[model samples]
Target: MQNPKMLIVEDCPAQQLFAGQLLKQLKIQHISYASDGELALELLKQQRADVMLIDLEMPQMNGVELLRSIAKQQLCQAVIITSAKDPLLLNAVATMAEADGLQVLGSLAKPLNKELLSLCLSRRKAEVWPADFERKAPAFDQKLLRKAISEQLFSLCYQPIADMNSGQIIAVEALARWSQPELGMVRPDVFIAAAEQWGLINELTLLLLEQALQQLQQWHDLGVVVQLSFNLSPLSLSDVAFMQQLQHKVQQAGIKPELICFEVTETQDFTQLSAAIEALANLRLAGFGIAIDDYGTGFANAQQLSRIPATRLKLDRSLTDGVSERPQQRLVLENTIQLAHKLGLTLIAEGVEKLADAMVIKRCGINLVQGYLYHKPLTANDCTAVLCNSSEQQAAS
Candidate 1:
């Protein structure tokens, strides 16, 4: 693949020179320079850049305005925010860029290092072309979604969460999958988002929850005592009656509530905070474990954590992917693990694909981990087979 076309938007002449030299040293041929957001916008109108390196403190048009324009006009495919200002300000800008539907490569503190810059550039160059189905998937509507629910087209795949110390499976997170006859397989992200948009989130969530409970019961019958964790929509939390019904169904299925954990996405806004807190509090009271999913990805403040009563905190994959290689990330992960422990919460590091990364998490005192390093999401039968094999191995030993 050809190198990505890049634009550097910085007002400082010396910084621009430094960046230009570095890009040339890296053998990147197509590079453009803009002193401010206005010039950047003008350059973008002439030709689109695949990636943009933005300095937030530019004079004419600040990085914030440039980012807004980029999001409004869909200018660059990816962004790298570079700032020497407050880390909080840098993070706020990056978060804003992401919220505006732009792929932020990451933030870079001023005086960017060659290695980090190369890594960011490499990621831009390595993006895969969209698959045919992804490019052509039909827009889903409420009628079709309702039909999907009624036809039971949704299925569950479980990814094992393991004890980092023992390296034994402790729990499995149930991820939803949807297979439409016409669409082939729709990604859970796609369907789940659509479900939420169409006010079908509650129905879809309960369906997956029921399926997970049934499978957990089956595993129990086979003497495989593994806990199952599944996501709960924020919309579902507003309905007290629905939560009550969920508890009743779990009791009716002869499944212990302790065998299941409901993961609440941190990315969602709790418009009904009190109701959500009460709903989750009730679930925990009834013996269910609650986890704050994608913990570091969202804007949830410390105050929110105190109200939710979460039993576990699942670190987002972004923080876990290369914690060993990145000092800043390692520090953050270490601090997060420390905070979780202080709050009496279990810490599960997700997206631990590399052994080196796993080692880093283990060193940081996180005992639970989930990622492709252990197992990818598996069908119920395959997961059961894994459990049975583990049981056999233990018995033989």
Candidate 2:
């Protein structure tokens, strides 16, 4: 498989050359450069780049204008770079783009140093591996991975969601995981994003869901009843054909309708409220439970909840972050939980990494909790073992 490509669009020839040389020094040889915004657009039209390094002040068609055009095309990923230190201009551009495709990788003043170069380069390769990743872990074999997910090389890890009041295993969130001979244990976020950009997200999601549903069916047969939540991309839901195929696959799996919940990312542009609501309502009518995942983090308002037919609200981790100290956030959480209850929707608190956070969530009356505090997402066998163990412990207590 070919390595991902990077495009450097800079107005200054000297800076462009410097960036190319730096990438070369880092052993990333597939580098392309553009002197101005118009040239960048022309080159991008012919060849798609995985990442684009753009300078703000270009002669014909400045960076902001170019970014707007790119957004319209949805062509290439863009990272803005500018010497402008004014917070107002930076905030305006960031708000306009909002990390959808346009991300501010780094801002370096006139003189760029090795540290800045390293930061930018590291950010570019972030999709390859996660941050703070240790070399002790095996590096991902991109070729093997591309073939594996395509040929059923991935696996499922179920993270137990415990009911705080009862301390009972109520539900489990299905997380996609992979372990190949070449790549010991691959992080799903990294490979999943890569798969989406490579136009394999639909296939990967179907495969993972198939495996997860089969396993959930087995658990159902064993009488261990619990809901299974699966994360889904906005694009996946937007495809009508894909949804039909998914419905067919789910029927074949024979998993109960109410037991499966499809979690849509809150980051997606739900600006067309009527269309989104219509789509979600259709899914709900089809017996697929709908949820607004990463709840408070997205642009969605409480009004959208009434409009959309989502059955559950998964609160964003940010709201629970530092809740012990941030009284304001705690108040917000209290209100959100109450609001969700008033709407007759189940509330799920996600990212419960700390015991204190989990405790806070329980006190806020959020019944379902999922995160590391309960147990990190585990393999299918491990999932069953955890559930069985939780049951045993409850009986003993």
Candidate 3:
């Protein structure tokens, strides 16, 4: 890996000088500067920069437009938005850039100092650059998805959720896995998005739900009482008939609804808010737990939170990755935990990959922790073995 070439797009001469001085001090060799978005566009067209530092407020074409152009032309691999106007506005612009398919490293307040610049530069260095900026997934159609579902090509894996105080595995979350015969192991993110687009999410969700419930039933027969959590598609919540079917299936499985939790991702858009709420309420009334998944990484607002009768809030990985090391992240996590507790919701911290982070989460009063620190998602047999071993340990103790 050679030295990264950086481009600074700032209209203010003073700010440009400041950034240049810092870059030089940091021993950065190749550097470029653009007075405005127009100049930046021209410079980008001529040469490629590994990372770009952009000022939001600019004459001619603004930073937002520059980001659009960068994404359109596949110019820069990463971007950092620096603005003095308003932090909220800058963050919005950064979100827009991300939506446009640009990797937004982060946002920075203007009058940037060496410390902040160094942090941004280090982050940029740590990023793994792809071979191509505009790499697209191979086209997958509805037919392929339906075939995969019908053939039972999808599988479920369980990730344990542990109690912070007892340090015991109390529950497990079911995650869907698919390996396309041709595509090898297709990522859940890729196939899931495709499933939603192709209107096959309900079918996929039901299949996984049935599989998870059946596995839970087997565990129950083995005398291992552990809760199971499974992701629920928002689209399924709008259909009353589907909800009835779900209830019927649970009854047939002879599994208590209380042992199962339906996790609704916060990123889902509830076009029919009333119907969704009614469905969730019905599920809760029927004894199933409702969890707001990926709490801080979505479009869900306070109003939405108040409306949904969620029993648990799962913190997103973005907030948990470095909570113990980063003060800002720790503060955010603490505040979120406090808010959840005030609302009478159990907080489950996700992405606890480090013991230090786990200690911080436990100290924050979050008892339910889930992430790779405990275990990765396991196959049904493996999960059952874990539960059996835990039961044996308890008996021996």
Candidate 4:
């Protein structure tokens, strides 16, 4: 394992030197320093640093401005130092910096304690790489997915999203589940990206749709008005042939188009914008609902949302991060809900990993919440069983 590198950007000479000494003591061999904001920005332009430690009060541009600059450059590491009492400023600076992917590793007060510095450095090491898929599972080959698809080796797990208020099993998000014949079970995150890299995302997606629609048809026959929500890949939206095939398959399923929802991550670039919009409009006109998935995490602006013909907004998981600590985050959630309501769009919150998180979302007036707290994604049989049981209970009550 390579030793992690650190970038210390402090305005004061003593503080910068102190950071350097701490890095040396920690046995971190590769260390870089920026005495002021300008030099730090210049250094970033020359070479990317693994993690950046920035002082909030720097001359010329200041730490916040440097953080923003680092973000514009697409540099991903940052740690902020400010006075202990000024947490609000620390948070404000962190949020502003994060917009550019310059995530704050941790916050350290001035007159940094050795223990605190060690903790920050350790945290910085963790954030150095954005979770490598291959390293985690070296045996999982990207090329193997092509064979997997050809061999019909993958499966879909449908996680039901019941309306909290109505307790109605309205929709299910199709999550990819895989159990390798040799390796046993592989995480979807590990294999899905591999599939995309190996040009099998579209194939995997279509397979899921076919399975989902068939299951939906079966559920409908049982008198269940279940809607199946399929995630839209950037590739799927851009491919005309895929869209035509999808249209044909939906017709073949003979299910109400309105009962099928296409959930896409929000994007501002609008690549294949006309084609994507046209296909989405066709789907909507055909009675299918369209939703913007992972709403707040994208580059979508207010005007962009107005232009898109989406019927629902699914809040990103990041919105709920640290909600318990930061009361103001509730305002963001509140405003998002209010905006969704104002736009006449159904709102669903994603990544509800805890019951407390769900309660917070419910109290904030969100209509639907999905996360591990409710259930992990289930197989088709399990999903059907859940919906049927919930329905029976509701009728009894």
Which pairs of residues have clashing backbones in candidate 3? 164-367
Q: List, residue by residue over 1-397, the lDDT tens digit for candidate 3.
A: 3467989999999999898898888888899999999999889889989889999889999998999998878888788889897665775676678667777766888788777777667655455544434555635677888999998889998999987676668899998998776667777877887887778888888888889888988898899999898888777789898889888888989999999899987554567888989999999999999999887775654555788999989887667765665566678778888888899998888888878888888898887889888878888899889888877877776
- Looking at model 3, how many pairs of residues clash? 1
Work out the TM-score per prediction.
Answer: 0.80, 0.62, 0.78, 0.68
RMSD to the hidden true structure, all candidates: 4.1, 11.2, 4.2, 7.4
What tens-digit string does per-residue lDDT give for candidate 2 at 1-397? 1345778888888888887786676666688988787898899899977767777778988878877777656566446455444544544464466434444455555445666655654544344323323333335545655688768988888888778877898888888887767556767767776776667788889999898888888887776777888888765666678877877888888776778888876444445555556666777988888888887764645665766688888887767644553455688789988888998898888878777777778888887887777778787898898787777788789
Ranking by TM-score: 1, 3, 4, 2
**Which digits, one per residue and each the tens of the lDDT, describe model 1 over residues 172-236?**
99999988877788877778878877788888877888898889988888988988898888877
Q: What TM value does model 2 have?
A: 0.62
Worst 10 residues of 2 by lDDT: 129-138
TM-score of 4: 0.68
**Candidate 3: where is the Cα deviation over 4 Å?**
98-101, 125-138, 162-167, 184-190, 193-199, 217-225, 266-269, 272-275, 296-299, 316-339, 350-397
Task: Give the lowest summed-lDDT range of ten residues in model 1.
Answer: 128-137
Model 1 TM-score (2 dp): 0.80
Ranking by lDDT, best first?
A: 1, 3, 4, 2
Write one digit per residue (lDDT tens) for candidate 4, span 28-47. Answer: 78888887889887787788
